[model samples]
Target: MWRLRDKYAIAGVGYTAFSARSSVTVRDLALEACGGAMADAGLMPADIDGVVSFHFNDSVPAMAVATGLGLPGARYAIDYQAGGNAANLIVQTAAMAIEAGLATNILCYRAMNGRSGFRLGGGRELAAHGVTQYTAPYGWISYPQAMAMWCRRHMIEYGTTSEQLGAVAVTCRRNAALNDRAMQRQPITLDDHQASRMIVEPFHLLDICLETDGACAVLVTSAERARDLARTPVYIMGAAYGGGPNQGDDLFDAMRWPDHSHNYARYIADDLWASAGIGPDDVDVAEIYDCFTYSVIMQLEGLGFCAPGEGGAFVQAGRIDRDGALPVNTHGGLLSEAYIHGLNHVVEAVEQLRGQAGARQVDGAEIALTTAGAMTCGGAMVLRN
Candidate 1:
């Protein structure tokens, strides 16, 4: 069967300093990250032929970034109107394009002024459309409130506790303390998580991810070309992007779906592992998307690291610590690190596979799993050195 395994590699990864606010425009941030990725790969702008990015009307278009970089000619360019879910999808698309011979080297990126401009967790009015038409009127407008329902259901069904969720927050903060690029570096204890003001019924202020202004970019090329690049080739062993039925049109459709405790990862894990030809035991490090502390738990379960309803316990057992059997979110993740959407998670996975993650680097890391989004639609990829 045809597969993307070991065919394309992420030749380089780059990012701008994450901050609560940036002095520059989102366009400039995109340019800077793209340029850095190109430089990291030892490729000039003229060598880039494809550009891809995704955003929710909060970032620049791929064409704009391509123009800014002064690409001699862009054969393929697209910008999907999406959020964190598109992080791995963009990379997958770039790999497919390279495999199809449509582009030699593709630059994928996401840049946003999330904190300074359009705050995802803020009270911005959502379009009263499909699911929002029914829920928004009842003040179910923001992501925290919507996702809190999932967390609450998991608690009732599996007896997941606030303390278990706190473990995720504390562990991620500890990892972030070693990441100079992370926004929230100070470590927090479970007591601190319990004491923090609650956002929704089951979520604390510490449980939610950070909103930061920054950008991240990566360069994808054939494995052959990657081996000759400036950086070590981090091969894309497996990739999957999608969700259960009807999730594409409305994410909140998950509410009516049968499984309230699980995310899209439940459906995609098999394909991800099959494509990579490895199981959860083979992953040396993980960068699971942690838009919320509960997200990490849910994904850990959905991705087959443990059986369903056991995620809370899995996290509480210290298995996700930096020195644990499977270190997760080693660069702090979105919870402690800046939310450049989930592209930064991809960058962290690349760094781990390359053995470039400094203080929090997992020992002898050879394979990494990076995921984006959790609740409804999402994407994931397995990378190896």
Candidate 2:
């Protein structure tokens, strides 16, 4: 239904190696990824006219790079506020900008030295969020705890088991072994997962995602330019982001959903699918956000791959494994890969579409959808050739 198809396309993508410490500053990381992307698109720095990404990025570094790249008359510097979703939302907005003749070339990026920077693992301070403030400051700490709380609830109310949760982590490590660029390249088994230390009550060390220092960037421009670039252009087939009114909540307070007693994940899935004109079954590959292992299972069912209480069974049956119908997180995901606010998953999906993913490449990935979630926050995008 949306007619902006050929108006804009992702011409290229680039990412710094995912690692705990890359020995580079955020400024160098942004430039590395951006330079790679521009080369991939066969575009010079002067070709860009606009830029978009998260507000968390260091602004001075990017401004200097824009001037260094010599982007001619770059006017719009759009900063979408929604963290992980921010990158994809920028993609949507960039498409709009191109359609409106506001800008011709746009770039979306998320770069951070989280691991070595000392900010990520420093302390609890994120409680600025009302619910997190109440819970996190009281020793809830960071992600695994917050995510584990959600996991424990699912187990309590729906009879979920730890083994079912381990399956997600195990499969991701298996996939990571296939992705050389992944931070965690060592192969892992279920025993390895179970043997890992427990970070939170219901979540193990393996259940947690990797915190690494890295950056990823993508170049988006008109489809015509995409054709003139290095490879087949992955089109932005469908995208949608929503909150409140219908769900009676915001992404900030994910558990506040009034209906279905906290079906927040399902609510995001409903909106994303409605806008895409496709469902879980139509997707060739999926790169769902896995900030925590259980979250992947939670999203699978929430996005309608199976029934609500059936997610555990679905994954336990190897349905999400590489040989399974829906090979998810084919790039190792945030669990084994770096946590760049879920932008890596978007890059992986684009690679899957381009057939450039080496050993981990899906046989014939034409259409894929990626979903990212953080409590009340989540976003999805569809891409095709």
lDDT of each: 0.90, 0.76
Q: Which residue ranges in model 1 land beyond 4 Å of their true spot?
A: none
TM-scores of all candidate predictions against the true structure:
0.98, 0.91
**Each candidate: RMSD:** 1.3, 2.7
Name the weakest run of 10 consecutive residues (lDDT summed) in model 2.
243-252
- Name the lDDT value of residue 129 in candidate 2: 71
- For residues 33-110, write the lDDT of model 1, one tens digit per residue: 999999999999889999999998888899998899999999999988888888999999999888888999999999
Weakest ten-residue segment in model 1 by summed lDDT: 246-255
Best by TM-score: 1
Per-residue lDDT value at 343 in model 2: 81
lDDT of 2 at 307: 86
Q: Roughly what TM-score does model 1 have, to 2 decimal places?
A: 0.98
